[model samples]
Target: MGAKERYILLLIIDSLIVTFSVFIGYYILAPFFLQYTMPVLITTSIILLISHHVFAYVFNLYHRAWEYASVRELMSIAQAVTASIITTYILNILLFQTTFTRLMIITWMMHLILIGGSRLSWRVARHHLIGKQSSDQEKLRTLIVGAGKGGSILIKQMLDTPAMNMLPVVAVDDDSTKQRMELAGGVRVEGKREDIEKLIKKYDIRKVVIAIPSLSKTELNEIYELSNHESVEVMIMPNIDDVMSGKVEVNALKKVEVEDLLGREPVKLDTAGIEEQVRDRTILVTGAGGSIGSEIVRQITKFQPREIVLLGHGENSIYTILEEMTGRNNNIEYIPIIADVQDRQRMFEVFETYKPNIVYHAAAHKHVPLMEYNPKEAVKNNIIGTKNTAEAACEYKTEKFVLISTDKAVNPPNVMGASKRVAEMVVQGLNQNCKETTLVAVRFGNVLGSRGSVIPKFRKQIEAGGPITVTDERMTRYFMTIPEASRLVIQAGAIAEGGEVFVLDMGEPVKIVNLARNMIKLSGYKEDEIGIKFSGVRPGEKLFEELLSEDEIHPNQVYTKIYRGKTVSYPIIEIEKTIKQLENNNNIKELLLDFVNRKEYTKN
Candidate 1:
């Protein structure tokens, strides 16, 4: 009903109940108090009616959603009724010089019951009639995996929101005490986690939602595996806090992704230390539009930097990141420079103008096979571009300079890896002489959901209804989320002294073929439905990528998931000479690889 109609209807009902309550109370006590006549009763009715509505409006009793009424709503009605009764008692003593004590007590009881019943009946009627009709519709039989507070809330929401078309049939909890216990909407916890497969068969369940927000990755993976039936789809509930706070709806369950099954806990950052180093500092990030660069920008903003210089070759990307940063925070100044890092003059001018306290040089050509095909382009961007930016940082006396290196740079076989290694050497070489700027490198493996990453490629192939290609069955690479990688980069800066290559502990290496299979399953397809194709490994691709070389391993973690490698000392002159050769050398790829791998370039 419309708000006006609901208000008027409730008002009429309350007025009638208020008038009848006083009259009935007077008549019931009339035998004892024979002196009180119809005139006195009529006077009491008028007083009760006005006082009830005034208190009702004060308590906002008329504006509540009675269809969703609970104890809280009933309590509001009680308070309003009691206040009105007290007002009527006081007015009776003043005007009639006599008060009906028994009548007032009886009237209060009747008024409370009638008002509360009128509101609570809406909830009872809606729950039975509307909920039953919704359940009768064609809905997926859902199985909830947790029977705690999160599970209870989810079940109630599912029952209340029939338009979602997910009928929660049963729930499962590992806790023995909760087994066979009924939760909201009469959905009982049928069995333990081990009984998931059996329950699916027993209930013919089509959907399973893991409702435990604090479930560990290992436990979540186990639950997902058990619920991985051909016709069944597994999903996860959003965080319980988010749901309760109205940030997201309970019905907004997300599909399980391979990233969730990685079984690695996120690394906790030293927030206090990071903030001390980053807060109010003028920070500069090259390649600020790319995946890792953009995430670093986002993470840095948390510390409330005074100003951020976003330098990138792509105008569109720079504009995009600039727009996003400005929308979120207006206090910090964001300067976007659409200039390539390879432009020495432009890089120098930017540094001189901003004189940033810290620099994150993320600009680079990172694709492996693509870099191999056009080694010159990789040399220009990755090698020379890094040199130009690092040199500018040194000249500008920047406090700290962080190089976003890659795992491929260790024991490298690809042009991209070799180029990044050369870029690292440039910073290491410069850090030797540049006392003002602390230059360090943070190395990590492939980040999930980055541009041109395997996950997005597999998703597109699955959407196209065909085979998802795996480069090789044996290919394995370390994986971390973009935010994790970026956060570690910032953390590395907090601990950086100089010339140290900080390797991130990218937990375990995952096989490429297995990752592809997981993606297909997560997309609600069987193995046969989306066939796997084993294309031979591409050029510059390795069977496995290493985070640190044997000689470079520090054997101790400097921080959580962050290790500082043994600094490799490279002669600044030779490093510059090799970069100069990239201008006209025909065998640029061969020369770049030779320079990075040669032991002679390192000092005794």
Candidate 2:
């Protein structure tokens, strides 16, 4: 309601409360003690009620904003009552000569009781009875997070008018100062965040509503980890400013996403580092349709580079990303070149014509089992394709060249891994003498959902109502999400001393079978209902992957969560011989096994 209408309704309600309160007080006490006329006492009571009601209205007591209300409203209540009692005292002393009578005490009690009760009753009645859902069984048994301002407001909002079938069962806060405090509507503070484990178990709580909006990302990540463990669903209330601005309602709570849990301090790009290199300069990206490549395009475009060349083999994928890019950002000039990274002549022409100042080489034959069957293809694309690009960049004198490497490249047990390792060596090798171009290799582990990644496969399998597949119960690999991997790649490139191989610390390794089980549970299926199937290991696949070989260790870390590996420099003449043979021969069975460590490269 508007301010004026709300004031009118409140004034009428408080006046009715005072009037009834006087009658209840006089009906019980007036007959027993007072020798005054029964009609006189009531008439005096009615006069007192009118005076107090008017006083409340004049003080704007009835129109106090509930959200802004606190202890201040209670003081206003006391003032309004005292105002009426002083008038009563004056009239009794001067007009009626009724000094300290039992009826006066009774009326005083009624004034406090009825006035306070009227407001308090509305709070209680609205929260638990009238505002609550008729079918109380629909309630979700929710737990409010902080017992502070936001938390108290949320509890009141939930009690007064709950949405989505949620009941505020408990509230928690770490502030020892507020441990025993009670919010309105009888919602008491439970304990602290540390009490969640016991509280959830004791109350059978299924939902946790995080009302602390200004908490940092790291803290949110920690809380999310705690919530995900017991399979408790979590929702976070928006910031208070959003609520105040009417941009987001009290009801617009958001779900905890992976980024909320997994992200680091958002990378503060070295603007001088980027602008110094990218401004008014040409940039090229291979595999531009892929996850890392596309994100790099997005990031690079933000630098206002002279031109961004999106180079990829897949026409449809390029067109889709191009369409999305255009729709979101219209000012940047982008040229989508549909060409394979493996095609030397095409890449050479594109590079020479564009003379890209920065080249992000993300293209490679990456599927481990598929590369095992087609080792020759792995050699051509990963090793030779990298050679072509590196050579072309050197010829064109590109200032910075970043090669995206994989964690599997470390002591690789697969053709795909070995090919990437070889590609890194090629970059490091060329950097030895190439003064015009600075070639750098940044390696990371498996991304969560790149093209052909297991996340999509698991999702598809779950959708199909079939078993989720895992290679082996013991197989494990490191994981970082795609955007994370992409961002780190950019950061790694910007920091590289030429030929340096940068690796991200991917935390602890996760087992594949356990990963599948987690996915099944996250999808809301019981383990018995959606079974897990063992597919056996694929060719050249390992039970676990590594980020560094024993010999290539960096004792001191470079970035907080990333490391640099000791370069395993190859003899230049031997690399030259291998490249010569790689270019001439159609078959690369032995050299592939030798370099890629392909144990399953035997002829079919």
Candidate 3:
């Protein structure tokens, strides 16, 4: 039916309900209300029908879609019923000049029940009692991981819309008291979370839905690990607040991504402090199109910077990030500067024009084996690039300058690590000399899912159907999500002091072989189905990586997940001399070692 037809049909139904309710109320109170004549009964019925219809229009009840009815819709029904009854009571007292007060109470209850139920019944008939079919083999048998609010809502939505192609057969929760309780559509809370694998096996489940939005990352990791199976697909609900606010539907659950497995407790940032540091200020992000740099720009945009300068070497990368930011129409000015950080003159020119209040230098040579083979490129990019940016920031009298360093820089094993160490020293040296700018280095570990990261490589191999390569079974490295690392870097800038190397608390080191195995399982393949190969560690690659050197003591934690390490002071002359030697034809590895150690310093 058309909207007008539906509205008129509902109006007619509501009119009948109002009249029948008043007649029933009069019949129930007939003995007590001895003064009830035919005229009085007729007048009360007329009053109820007219008043109810008028109030229904006021509440916009007939205009609403009953198929999507929820709590708000039910509340509107209640308001209309109450208003109509009150209006009828007043009309009866004035028009009929008869006190049917007791009868009015009876009529009110009956009218509310009949009218409200009449409207809500359509929703029930549409969602719960209509078009439901028997469990079919073609439909996916789904398991819900939580038996809480989110889970209940998800089950209801699924049952309401069978076109989603998933049938919720069971639910599990950690709350022992809730065991054996039935959620909507009779999906029982079968057992505790530990019984997931058993439940999946018993039910022949094909899909797992994590419906607890408040679950900690640690708990999520454990659940994902338990649910990893060749036949099962995993999905998760969005944040609980979003679901409750109608910003997201319970049925709109997303597939679990690689970053979710490494998620930790959500970081709580110092928004006020960050705002004070970034708001209304000119910000410069070097390598802004890169993984960490791009995330930094996105987060910084939330603080409403006056202007953002996207500085990178490649034009395509710079153009892509600029378009994304502008397409959002964030209303913040973005200056895209395609300049290589290795060029000192270009860095100076950009800084001179922008005069950025804060500079986040994320440009560096990160891939270890590649940097080891081309040591000169590593030095020129990681080391000299940093020096150029730092010198330019200091020269321009920037308020705060942050260099993105890595865990590899802790105890050097490769040219990449040594170059980062030397870059850290350059920042320290500049902090000593330049009194105006607050120079600091933020050190983190491997960023999960970044370009050229192992996660992507393993995912591709899994998709290709064989031989997922791992450097070694024993090799492990600390991992943090790109957003987590970028946020920490911004936090470090906010809390920076001159000459401090801030280290983020990378929760724990994850073994590469285990990560690979999890990826295989997540891909719905058994280990035998897709073989894992142990390629021996490559050149300059260590069996493990370190976050901080043994001699560097982390005496204070500046923020949650952020620690301040005691600064290591090296002579500026020694650093400059090492750079000079690196410029000429010399043993790149020896010069890098001497630069990092300062023990066997030789003047060029």
Candidate 4:
């Protein structure tokens, strides 16, 4: 309706209500009171009609759309009605020197009901009568998981806005108390989560919307696994806090991705302690362009450091990170240094120039097969580079040095893993000898979306509509997200005293084939649609990755989900001699393999 028409209609309806309420009130009270004669009652009714219309105009009741009325609108209605009757009572006394107190009270009560109910009835009629017709004809039946505040909000939105394309049919919650409870728009918490499949069949549900935003990753995976039994589409709601804060709308739901299933619970850290160490301190991060190193840079920026020195071998990757950090954190200082970790002299030069208070050594040759082919580069980058950085840290009296080690370093089979194992020894040895600098190593498994991780490879293959390659059906690896890994790395530095090798608790080892299958499904394809190829394991690749070797005992929990791996006594001079011998040896690959095998052999 047009604005003029709506205003006119509301004005006329309110006038009739006021007139009727006053007339009925006077009729009932006329027989009891002789002062309230028929003429006097008629005159009083006329005065009330005029006074009510004046108050309603002053309160702007006609300007509002009653169909969308809420508490604020109802309060306005009460105010206008009260003001009209109060004004009538005063005027009747002033003119006739008499008052009909009982008559006015009855009229006031009647005015409230007739006016408030009329406005509320429009919303009720639309939701129950009109909305049900549209929902039944056009909307898809949606089953909502989680019958909490988030689910209630989603149900109201769906009912109020049919253009959202789905109507909530039923809700499921794990809390038994909530069962048999009804939510907004008549959506009921019919049963528990285990009954989801049955409810889907019973209601002929086409879509399932998970409305719990605060669900832990572990619980989310369990719920999704159960919900995926049917061929219906599944969507997940974004964080409720974000929605409430207006960062996103309540209807902003997205398809559950592969990362959601494989991810673990978010790691909580001591931000105050981290800030005390990093704030106002000059920090240097080697390999600042690589996946893990770059994320470390980003995470450290949150600590508000005095300066962040981005030292990397590649100019382009370094430039990319520098640009991103510049745009995101313009208040902090970022110094981009293009230098390789293998250059011992250059490493000392960068350390002396920056004089960084804390150092995060992340540069290393991490590709297993490629490092297996080129063992010399692995030794140069992983072992010697670590030695140079560790020794430089000690010389410059850097407060703490954190080396990023991997799970492959445990019972090492590949040159890359062996190199990292020796690097850990280098850091521990330096920490043992030097009292000024506290050196520690953090060991974790493959990060989910790192530069050369299998996640991106599987995604590419799925996007190309071809066979997705898996090394072996039985091969398994522990996975953590990049942010989680980087946070734990910083946590290690926070918890380190000296010479401690920290191991992160990677929840479970996921089978490689299962990872591939999930990626295919997330990409909107079935197993048969995208063929799975069993590519034989590559050289230096293990059937399963280990977080810690058998001899490395975890004697302490430094923080939750983080443990301290006991440092083995290895002579610093012996480790130095091995590095020198590696440079001169013609059979470098054999020596590297033996170096790692001897460590495991000693463990036995």
Candidate 5:
């Protein structure tokens, strides 16, 4: 309605309510009190009508849209009702001396009911009238896998938001107490999880929205495996803390991506340990623009570092990391230095200038096939970059130099892996000679959505409306989310002493075919229709990638989940000669073969 029309409607309604209340008060009390008459009561009624209108303005009564009225609206109603009651009491006490108890009680009840109900009535009406109509036509029949606070709030929000177009038909929860119980919005909690298939068919549910955001990876994977059943697309609500903290917006309610389905149980780390390492310290993240480097950059900032240097080779990467760091944390000092790590002079300059107490060397060429094709570049970047960074750390008297190595470095068949093996050797070899700096390496598997990862390639293909290609059906690789991998790297750094080849226990390897299949399904395509083309495995692509070799394993007493691998050690003379040959000559192929065949650059 227009402003004029709304104001006129409000005035008319307030006038009628005020008049009716006074009239009723006078009628019942006239016989019992100082001979009250219609004219006196009529005068009082007119005054109250004006007074109540003023009260309504004070409460922002006309300002509020009743569709959103709740406890807050009711609170305002109480305040306004109190104001009207005081005004009425004064009028009857001073002029008529007719304070009829029963009459006043009736007025009080009527005033609250009539005034408060008016504001809330429209909202109740909207749900019943508008909601019923919309649900019949526009609702997406959905099932809730978790019948908890997160689920209930999501359901309420859906019901309140008419545009959501989602109607939760059933709630599936494992909590026995919630079973067969009706929630606030009359949503009934069904029995335990075994009833998923039954509930899906019973409700004819088209979609499933999981409300357990804080669930451990194990719990999430279990749920995903169950929901992998046909025809029921799944989604996840933001976790409890996410909703409360406002990190996950209401619109962030979304379908389950591959990560959510493949995730493992949550790992509760010693935050105290992490904070102890990061707080009040200057941290240098090498390759800060890359996936893992950026994540460590993110995670470390949360602990409020003294300063963080975003050291990377690529100019664009430096800018991107600087941009991200600036957006997330402005309080901490972040310097983006773009310099190739292969240059000893450049690395030395960075170390002498920044003087960072802790250095995280994440700079490396990680792509397997790409590195295989460009072995020379890989050696120069990965092996040489790592050596320069480590030596500079030692020279600068840095406390810890953590190298971000990969599982590929262990018994590696590819050039990328072989170079990383040499890189690990450089770090550990430095640790042996240098006592001031503790050089360590954290080895883990592929990170999903990293640069040149299969996930991004599949997404791009899907967006272009074409056949999504997979290297091989039987090919399998362990995976972790980008941020998760980075966090683990930081955690590994915090936990490292010296020459500790810490390997994160990546839960299980996922088959490449299955990953492709899930991505296809998520894009709303059937297998046969939007065909998945099995492109033959590229050069250096293995059928199955192993985290470690059979012989290079040992139990660590400190952290059971992390194991230390046995690495072949080279004589200082041999190491120096190999590095000199690599730097002097561009023939990385000869060095890689000799290093791999002799296992001279093997795991530690």
Candidate 6:
């Protein structure tokens, strides 16, 4: 109903209740109606009606959404009725010269019951009507994984919103105290997380939602494994911030992603240190169009930099990130430069023109197998590109230059890994020669969801229906999210003391075959349905990837999830000579590997 119509309806209903309560009190108190004059009774009824509405207006009883009434609404109704009764009792003393204290108390009791019941009935009726209508529509039977506040809110939202087409049949919580307890919408906590499979079958659950916001990645992985049924689609509640801010409804559950099962807590950045260094500083990020590069650019913008120079070879990628950054923040200057890092003159010109305070060199040839086929391209991009960028930064006297290295750089096996190792050497060597700039390298493992990563490839193969290919059944690689990788890169810049090789703790190496199986399950498919094919190990690929070499290992962390490696310093002349010889060498891959693996370069 319209607000005016609702208000008018409540006003009329309240008038009748007020009038009836006064006369009913009189009738009950006086056995013979003749004890009170008709005029006195009529005057008492008028006084009660006027006083009730005045108090109702004061309490905003008419403005409340009665269809969702609760204890608060009942309290408002009681206050309004009690105030009106007290006012009527005072008027009876002045006009009739006799206060009807007994009658006033009886009337007050009647008013509370009638007004409060009327508001509550609306809520009950609406729920019943919604429930009856929901029975006619097809709804997915869902199982909630947590019986906490989040789960209760989700259940209530699903019940109230029948259009959502989700019927929360039962909830499962690991808390023993909450076992067999009922939550909002009368959904019972049937069992614990381990009983997910059994409860799904028992309830005929078609969907499962993990509603625990504070659940650790390890616990989430466990719950997901138990709920991984082919027929039952699993989803998770949105982040707590998104729900509390009203950005999305409590019932808006998102699909469970493979990233959620990584079982590693995100590395917390030293925000104060990062902000002190990056805030209002001119920051330059090369390869800003690629996955990790773009993410680095995004994270840097949060610190409110004075200017950001997005330098990349690809125009489209640079333009995409530029548009996104511009839309989000107009105060910070976003300058997109379309130039290759390998172009030495252009790099120098760009650096000299911008004179960025900090430089993040992210442009590199990262694909292992692809780099193996074209080793020359890997050298030109990863090694020479990093050299050109680092030299430009040193020449321009940049405050800090961070080289985005990889785990592949540690005891490298592939051309890509070897090239990145050379790139790291280039920066460490430059750090010694240039005292004005603090140069460092941050090495991490495979970034999930990056271009040509396993996760995206697996998703595509699953979408095509069956036969997800694994390079090798025994192969393992450390994995981290792009944002996590990027944030650590920025954090490394904050903690960089010249020439330190900062190694990110990738937690543990995940077996490729197990990762494939999990992806298939997350996509709502069985192992048999999405058949896994062994492609065997490709050229330049290793059975496992490492974050740091034995010589570089540091037992203690300099920061949370960040380790500063004891790296060997190479003569800048020898590193430059290797870069010069690789341009025309027929055996570039062998030469590159030999240069990086030399034991003599170790600082002893």
Task: Tell me, by lDDT, which candidate is best.
Answer: 1
**TM-score of model 1 (CA atoms):** 0.95
Candidate 5 per-residue C-alpha lDDT over 387-489 given as tens digits, one digit per residue, 9 for 90 to 100: 8889999998998999988888777778888888788777777788889888888889988888888888888888877688887878899998877777777
Cα lDDT, model 1, residue 342: 83
lDDT of each: 0.90, 0.76, 0.87, 0.87, 0.79, 0.89
Name the lDDT value of residue 242 in candidate 3.
93
> Clashes in model 3: which pairs?
none
Candidates 1 and 4 compared: the better one by TM-score is 1
After TM-score superposition, what is the CA distance of residue 216 in candidate 6 from its true location, in Å?
0.9
TM-score of candidate 6 on Cα atoms, chains taken together: 0.87
Clashing residue pairs in candidate 6 (N, C-alpha, C atoms within 3 angstroms): none
Measured with C-alpha atoms, the lDDT of residue 219 in candidate 1 is 92
Which wins on TM-score, candidate 2 or candidate 5?
Answer: 5
TM-scores for every candidate against the unseen true structure: 0.95, 0.74, 0.86, 0.82, 0.91, 0.87
Q: What TM-score would you give candidate 2 relative to the actual structure?
A: 0.74
Off by over 4 Å in 2: 1-135, 148-153, 160-162, 213-231, 237-269, 328-330, 571-573, 579-589, 596-604
Q: Which 10 successive residues of model 6 have the least lDDT summed?
A: 29-38
The segments of candidate 1 whose C-alpha lies over 4 angstroms from its true place after superposition are 33-35
Over 4 Å off, model 6: 1-15, 29-67, 72-109, 136-141, 194-205, 239-245, 302-304, 328-331
> What lDDT score goes with residue 438 in model 3?
93
Name model 5 segments beyond 4 Å from true: 2-4, 29-35, 90-101, 128-138, 183-187, 240-252, 328-330, 584-587, 597-604
Clashes of each: 0, 0, 0, 0, 7, 0
RMSD, model 6, all Cα superposed?
3.6
Best-fitting candidate, scored by TM-score: 1
lDDT of 3 by residue, 1-604 (tens): 7998988889888888788777787778777666778877888888888888888889998999887687888889889888988888888889878677787788777766776777688887776544555343377899999888888888888877777888899999999999999998789999988999999999999999999877788888888878887779898988778988989877788888767888677699999999988999999999999999999999999999999999999899999999999988877999999999999999999999999999999998899999989999998999889999999999999999999999889778789999999999899888888889999999999999898899999999999997899989999989998888999899999989788889999988999998888887777778889999999999888888887776676766779999888876667777888897897855898779766875543221
Could you tell me which residue pairs clash in candidate 1? none
lDDT of 4 by residue, 1-604 (tens): 7899988888888889887887788677768765676677777888988998898888888888666577899999899999999999998899889876898999999999998888898678767765656845767889999998888888888877767789899999999999999998789999988898889889988788999978888788877776774357778988888988999999888998878888888878999999999998999999999998999999999899999999999999999999999998447899999998888899889888989999999999899999988988998899999999889889899999999999999887788888898899888877778989999999999998898999999988988996999988999999999999999999889879988889999988999999888777666677899999999999999999998776787766779889888766567887788889998987876777676666432220
